[model samples]
Target: MSYQALYRVWRPQRFMDLVGQEMVTKTLKNAIITHQTSHAYLFTGPRGTGKTSAAKIFAKAINCRFSKEGEPCNECETCKAITEGRLNDVIEIDAASNNGVEEIRDIRDKVKYAPTEADYKVYIIDEVHMLSTGAFNALLKTLEEPPANVVFILATTEPHKIPATIISRTQRFDFKRITAESILQRMIYILDQKNVDYDDKALKVIAKAAEGGMRDALSLLDQVISFGDNNVTLDNALLVTGSVTQESLFNYLKFVLSKDTTNALKEIQQIVEQGKDANRLIEDLINYCRDLLLYQQAPEMVSDGELGLLDDKFKELSQQINVTQLYQIIDELNKQQENMRFSSHQSIYLEVLTVKLTQLSTNSEADRVSNVDLSQIELLKQKIENLQRKVDNLSSNTVQTEKNNEPRKQVRKNTTKGQKNVKINLSQVYSVLNNATRQSLNELKQVWPDLMNMLSVTQRAIMHVSEPVAASENGVVVGFEYAFLCQKALEDQELIDTLENGLDRLIGKVPSLVLIPVENWPEIRSNYLKQRKNGAVVIADDTSEQSQDNDDQSASTQPTIIQKAEELFGTDIVEIKND
Candidate 1:
């Protein structure tokens, strides 16, 4: 006999042989035992979940002459004939290839006839969702009221596509995805029956890679068996599944957790050089992180058998990073996974992810510093209120002084040569400074990438040179890399509108734009600070002298927060507001 695949050769012949669908199998067997089997039955689930196999087994059980307790005796002539696909009474249809009104009409016309040899005639249609709309309509009436002793079985992976009218006329059985444990047990049984040498770890790897599909697991096992010359080993399983070894994943994660980007990149380079897929490496890392997180939360829940070769180092690493850091890493890796689908330069993203992971600990620390306690927040609020009161007093004095002075009528004049020109929106700049917060600014920065993604290619390119530097509730200050781009961006009303729409979609609010060139940012910011100092009363929140010292130190020791904000928002739209 010619070679047959293990999945085909070991196809389930009885409900008892089927794994991971006890509810479905038990229900069908009970229906047969009670002699209350429905005329039309619909089976739905993921591929290789045994929908078709269950349908076949049910067909044999209903027709077998020597059936006992709703189970088919395979030795019977009727069972053997159906199993061999030569039974005249039992018809198997592949709806994918023959999904047309004419084919269903033919079935509809033939279902009225009685069985030729068996007690009942059975029709098994696989992938019934592939049937055309008209074909489904044709099958509906016959399915609703079929001839006596006739059974119809319709199976599909996608139950949503089937028409409601057709679905209402049949008994629906939802087959679930087979569990890994069940799949492993079944594979071990088969291996033992065949007297094949196999490693338990190799079987586990196969089961995990199958992703709840028995046929897929068996097919992978068959390939591994052939590749290993009848002895299934862990190495063979990894080669077949394109899965990284546990040691490699652990080492890569260890490098990331320890903030060793250089070693991490070297490890990735080695993996890539060995012909391993960059995407797969990322997937493995993400899974490892997930396992580590799970292990941390419920150590007893996670078994080494299920995860396939876990080491004590995973638990140690879990202890090294908190849950928040692990969640952030997983989220970033997931985003990279999505990016990999669209990007041809997957390795670049992988390298970028490695660097990002190494920085998570530092970023978390910085976040802790920025997220002050409630008492500190209340103190900051009281100081802001005090400053507001001082500003009010200063404003009243300025208004009285202006009223006391005479109003001068000025003549309209044009600027001449050698005049230093300054163009700044003082009112808008003041509003942003008054309302700015580390939290709101960080919020905008977080969604900036998403906003950019929503923009058209042209708009993104036009606005790429700019970023949000300072943000208020009602407005944001955008800094441009080049003065010309800033000028152009201001002139392009359509681009601004697109940005507003994109902001609304991504961040749920849009703010007014305050565009300034990077070259002119320092001058503009200095002028605003000078105006605030000259026009407002200095309160004793942080002594005026200390505030000045802090300002000078901030400028000298590091860039001002505004400068850091400029870098973060990037010469683009810095912030957005609802109004």
Candidate 2:
């Protein structure tokens, strides 16, 4: 007897025998039980998921000589013939080859006939989408209003090409991929029955590589297994498929997260040097990222299919890479995979993809800085605020003493014939100035050492006199220094009485009055008589004698205030009377 491959030997023989297609099987079973079977059916979905098998079972059940509860009794000759493809009443058509209008016309003529032996004549058209529009249209009329005791079952991997008219008249069943668990369970059953030695991990890898197709999984197992071999291992599975382990991809991701470009590149180099498929490597990476995303969202769970083989460590790593980064990495890997098709340097494309991934590792540096936990930022802000408070306390504790409230007197230099001299006590004047003006005055005083602590400094004023006036009859006029001009103007009303009294009390005479810029002093007075008229005691207009008289006045004024105040308060306070 010739050998039968695993997939053919394992083909589902009944509705219940089909794996992972319970919905279709159950519906078909109920339909058969109720005798509510449709004349035509369309089964569509991914390959290897049992659309054709379901169609066959439905045919067998409907045509069986003796049926029990809508299930075929294999004991019957009619059911056995249909199952073995010997019955003329049940016909399986490969629409791919018989897809022209002429071939369909032959089917159209056949639909007119009555079944010779079976209760119903069934036509199963596989890959019906391959039929041309003319062929589809030719068959649509008979399909919509088919003869009694006739059934049509259309199957296709791609159904979009089938016209809506044909699809609507037929009952449609969309078959889905048999899930990993379903496929793996089936694989285990087959291996056990075959007495093939295998590890669960190897089976899982094969199941995953099949990607939800039972046929693909079984076919893969056949390729990987040597029937006489002791057992299958993860390594043998990896080698047969040219696929990398999820662990390798996970380690590459760890290197990527840690920004270990060198190690990541070296790993890729190792695989590239071994001549492993670069595109498959990218595919493995993308799947790895997918699992990582699942890990983060769904807890530490993985597929019993392939993920069961990986240890808990890979699962933990899966949780570390979140969906966002995983998506980004997969996007990059996909782009690199696309680039590899066109580029001559396949290894370089993979390297570039890894390098781009590693660059994202540095963004974690910025993340480290910005990720300063809210508590840390708050702590630093609080520390700054505390230091500010400390500074405020120190400043508050430091002492500052207020000066005396005595009027700030402006000093006046005695005018000699050839010298220009003017004076006043600054301290007395500043005491009366407003706060803002006092600050300006202090700043101005910095340029003059004597003025810094002095009561005042007099500016010689401008005056015009048409006639000479008696000294005792006129009151003395005081002009403020330039820096205090605004202060002097603001307090001009305040100084009237003080000036008049001080003139009489200190000089013992009411000198004639004038106020002017200090620069205009010489022109206001010519000699002693002119000075008395102008409210200045200009003894002579001669420049030489002016210097001598001014020297005598300073010698007298400094001692009276500084010397006396020094003895009284232990602080220097100079007083200069402008009168």
Instruction: Write down the lDDT that model 2 would get.
Output: 0.67
Top TM-score: which candidate number?
A: 1
List RMSD in Å for every model shown.
19.0, 20.8
* Candidate 1 residue-wise lDDT at 416: 40
Worst 10 residues of 1 by lDDT: 540-549
lDDT of 2 by residue, 495-576 (tens): 4444444445544655433333332233222233343567853332111111111322322334454445634643224333
What's the residue-level lDDT of 110 in candidate 2? Answer: 85
Q: Distance from true position, residue 265, model 2, in Å? A: 1.9
lDDT of 1 by residue, 369-398 (tens): 677666688886777566556545655774
- Name the runs in model 1 displaced over 4 angstroms: 304-308, 364-376, 380-579
The lDDT for every candidate, in the order shown, is 0.78, 0.67
